[model samples]
Target: MTSRESALIDALRMIATHPAARGLADDAAVLPVEAGGLVLTHDMLVEGVHFLPDDPADSVAWKLVAVNMSDLAAKGAMPLGVLTGHGLGRDRDWDSLFVEGLADALRIFNVPLLGGDTVAMPAGAPVTLGLTAIGRAPECGAPSRSGAKAGDDLWVSGPLGDAGAGLAIRQGRMDGGLASLVTAYQRPQPNLPLGQALASLVSAMADVSDGLLIDARRIAEASGCGVAVQMDAVPLSDALMMVRPDSWETRIEATTAGDDYVLLFTAAPDRRQAIEAASSRHGGNARRIGCCTADRGFALSWRGGAVPLPARLGFEHG
Candidate 1:
């Protein structure tokens, strides 16, 4: 194994001292929690791949929470705590300020910091963020990507493509609200409450990390069903709306771009009203984007017409 892998495993082992992270599993880890199995998920963010080196500390920290929590929110898991693995600089002050940003995010998410490790990268090629988040299942159940069923109502917590917009502006791809797109990229408010409320309601659920079109396909395949999303129904923020509405390419940008951190869920028509009411109570924005069909085809409807899946799909690693 590489040294980096060894160090990561060792550090994770220490945090396992808690009731949650104990005796980690290699391929996958399972922790016995109080209420059913609290789904466990961890994502490692590399400086360039996940965030730019020039990104602000506060923004970076917020992105960490947004990404890790996205997993739990999709699983209908309640926030428990997060284990942070820090890679710091030789200068102590630089590292301390980073901690402050991370602390700020934890406060916002109401998620505790279980524990983590600290290490210095001599060359500092790219600092990595390792976050392990644990969340309990809802009282009624946990939502799974594989649970989607035919005739289910497909929905997303909010509009799509803000994070992609944020990245575009940052990379000079296009000029727009740095703040608005940034919020979609950073400080993502995981639809935790909505997920919990829909735990028993949603036939299937997943977070929109990789464009709606792509992630929706995942649910469809996993659940052995076909999905049809209405392009006009996909929500958009005032920030993303500024991206040249006349241009179909730009519109596709937001649609295919991922990292919105909203929940993509499917439910029975019978439960739509109840789900909407619950969402209002949770203070989450949700809307019906499409529907699931028994036929095995993934499609999108635009301007009252149906079309094949966009070739863009979503984020692809590698």
Candidate 2:
């Protein structure tokens, strides 16, 4: 399951299989259009849940856009535009800053603002923002979480755990001296180009929105296979290492920590060269972390021994 929230989605899925929903197996809804299919996704961010009150409004806006874009990237779709839903707050200056951040994200990602609605909420209500992202898929079917096969090599686009480190900084648990960690948590870079390149090449793909363990399990469950993640192969950014020491425990936390929007995909061993070339072309430091197995769940291993699964896979809501 992609989320523990799947119980509600499962109930909705019982009645919501519109063919265009793709059985609700993939991240975005695909609607067959004239030239190709249109990929559509909507995501919401609450004030305290997704961002802190003291965090920059612009960064919050940027994160809202980036997170949605990350979903599109998973489907190997090129973003067309976005429609925003904004909850107006009492602080007009904060709202203005959010607009600036939103504008910056739009310009940076080359996605346009198609338009949306805004509402004035109660005085102290938390600000909630949502975005509906629309994209166009290629002639080939959009890559899906259910596409991974046994014997497929699993790969991740870049480093993990940096955002978790950044989150700690924002919470004042650590000094904000490490700019990379702070920036990673606040503004994430989705591998759009790599996604485009691997559209037809990879067997399955997803952006690591939740922790890597949970997200990888999503593909495994959707594909009806098992996934074995090599703990040592999980890459950690130098920035993260600078703040946290090098150890297996640190690696596990990095693997399970959320907010790193890196692309995780599976490809046949034969496609290694092409995958490497694509990553190089896109400025991504791709790593082969593990492989899909014929079994039914996740297995973690390092230094010739298996590691116990963590009690918690990732962030889960009550």
Candidate 3:
């Protein structure tokens, strides 16, 4: 009789009694293990919903692994291996490309393929893929999304909205020649090293799988605080700017667009120097776009004026 949210709460109450669950507030579950801890997370992607039916099978396979690895990055855990659930397609070429793409992702991320299962779906059914990523938590412990404190500065690992633009291209809403945007959508790099550097430094952290505003609001709700983002501070790829004009509307669209697997985290203002240094050391880009507030909601500001929130924050499954 319980709703999905309520059912999740009840299940957590029953199964997350152990201290290692991290109260189920993080992207991955942290369980105590020898010498340190283990971080486990699983993510699923479906055809037509997560990708265009004609999209490249290799890219789809890469996304399936990258998205799961992004969750591991959020936990500040180093990826050890992955288990894949592959739904065999009728097309032999597509399946072969998918394997190649899977191999590419595993090699790029330096993760091993532990094992997995494959099953043939019914004729005309959509393909569904799943990945389970296992990681080892750092000595300081994995970062949680519920640790942001008031006055902490919010930062993002890199630019946003390119993937959204890439999607628009794939949908034929835009002209061609923007291969960077297309590639951004197809191959997203998870900031694993930056996450490890922030494990002990940041108060809270998460990967930007959803819209930036929505993900920020999630952290705010979890930490029981408010967050105000400065629209001007959001980084945008040059490719996106060339396609879309600069304006508040464009900024809003960029922030609310999804599919960017960048890390969003909060750190003390005093740690600004250290954070920047860590980002540089990890060969990652970071920008401070907001700050945590004592209030209990999310806010947006630009040029000393408030920007109204959009009706839809980002891609919604349901």
Candidate 4:
């Protein structure tokens, strides 16, 4: 394996503190919850993409925590702690700040620290981040994007586009409340408890890292059903509203921009009451943004009517 691949394997081994972590095939490191089920998740950040060229090491570390936590949120996993694989530059200050930011995230989430790794690299290389969080799912079964069902109602925890707009602002687009929006993009709050509350109610679940449109399409494809979204029903941040009065183009990009880190889930038509109850009990917001249809294709409601969507896609790494 390449050095990076070897690093990944070594990092996995370090975090594999649980029995299930033996194979390391699962996305997160799963472990028994002590009282009951299981919990696990992973978060990865790439330089120049997830962060700025001059991004602070601490901030990058915070993002490392947030992204992984977001995954656990989709699975309804409670924070246990984290294992980190951080790329180090020649500067020791950067490494310290990175750990500090990670510590900040741990404090906010009330999680503990597990062991991790540090490796030196040639200077000026792009910084990279990887974290795997262990947690408690209570029942061992966390939700997956693949479990969505036809005729189910789709919901998102909060507004969309803020994270994307944050990136735009950082990249010098329109700028207002850049801090909050950028913070959203930077330190996403994973809705872990809320996800657990939704466990029995949601048929399928996923974190909206990729834009809602793309993420929803993933769920649809996984469930072998088509999804229809009400463009008007999508949530928006106050910052988004200020800059995007003509939100038409913004909506399209935001719907596809990746890195929102909110939950997108599906519920049965008959389970609306269950959903409402779940939201109330869990203390999170969830709106019926759209529905899973028998159409066998993804569609979106534009200004006047529903239009068929081309193949749903996201950022290309290559």
Off by over 4 Å in 3: 1-33
Every candidate's lDDT: 0.76, 0.84, 0.83, 0.75
**What lDDT tens digits, residue by residue, belong to model 4 across residues 153-272?**
999887788888888888787656547888777777777778878877788999898778878988999988999998878878777777777456667777787788878999888888
TM-score of each: 0.86, 0.88, 0.88, 0.84
Model 4 lDDT, residue 13, Cα: 50
How does residue 313 of candidate 1 score in lDDT? 85
Q: Which residue pairs does candidate 3 place in steric collision? A: none
The pairs that clash in candidate 4 are 209-259, 211-258
**In model 3, which range of ten residues has the least summed lDDT?**
8-17
Per-candidate RMSD, Å: 5.1, 9.5, 9.6, 5.7
Worst 10 residues of 1 by lDDT: 21-30
For model 2 the local lDDT of residue 70 reads 94
Model 1 lDDT tens row, 53-74:
7777667777887788889888
* CA shift of 47, model 4, Å: 1.7
lDDT of 1 at 227: 90
Better of 1 and 4 by TM-score: 1
Give a tens-digit lDDT track for model 3, residues 140-160: 999899999999999999999
TM-score pick, better of 1 and 3? 3
